[model samples]
Target: MAGESTGKKKKTGMKSFIGGTILTDERISRQFPFVVMLAMFGLALIMNRNWSEKTIRQIGDMQKELEALRSEHATISARLMDASRPSEVAKKVNEAGIGLKEPVKPPRKLVVEDN
Candidate 1:
């Protein structure tokens, strides 16, 4: 019995794995499609997370820019209102020495008869 057992060759688990013979097993082949599908799902999940983070960053940047623009607009509007006052206009005109003056008299109204 010892001689017969020694004469027969048996493949060990470690030997078959290291020798790359385990990939040819029927069980591994049957599960190959399921393994590939799982890998694809993992890749898609990672991509989705990356995209969501990028969009959030972009929205934050846009909000900052909008705030800056709003402040600028308010400053410009205030400056325009101050510069358009009658006193401010007259002062600028006098500084330029254009020799133009406000009317001193209240003029009489003219009435014409329609034919």
Candidate 2:
């Protein structure tokens, strides 16, 4: 019974072999791979910064585009507003040869009952 219990404990203790020994070993300093990992992390950080800067530039460009579009919209709206005035509409209708002219009256009619 004692041997069986010891064997079970040994089996349980053997499960943590996923680099724990290499990390805890005193003879090997954890510097070379740590520096490499830090370098990789630093490179990733630099690339992310570059990407964010490009995104910021794109956002700025979009803002400029929006302003230009708004200016065009204002110009068009002003033109439309002017064109909607009664005098301008009448002038344009006259230019297009469409306006109120002389009326053409229809003939009168009479009806009789049929039985």
Candidate of highest TM-score: 1
lDDT (tens digit, per residue) of candidate 1 on 1-115: 4546655454548888899887787767799999999999999999999999999999999999999999999999999999999889888999999997766797889999999
TM-score of each: 0.71, 0.59
Model 2 residue 93 lDDT score = 78
Candidate 1 Cα errors over 4 Å, as ranges: 1-19, 103-115
lDDT of each: 0.89, 0.77
lDDT of 2 at 86: 76
Candidate 2 structure quality by residue, lDDT tens digits, 14-47: 4445635554543335576887899999999999
Q: What is the TM-score (0 to 1) of candidate 1?
A: 0.71
Q: On a 0 to 1 TM-score scale, where does candidate 2 land against the true structure?
A: 0.59
Off by over 4 Å in 2: 1-30, 101-115
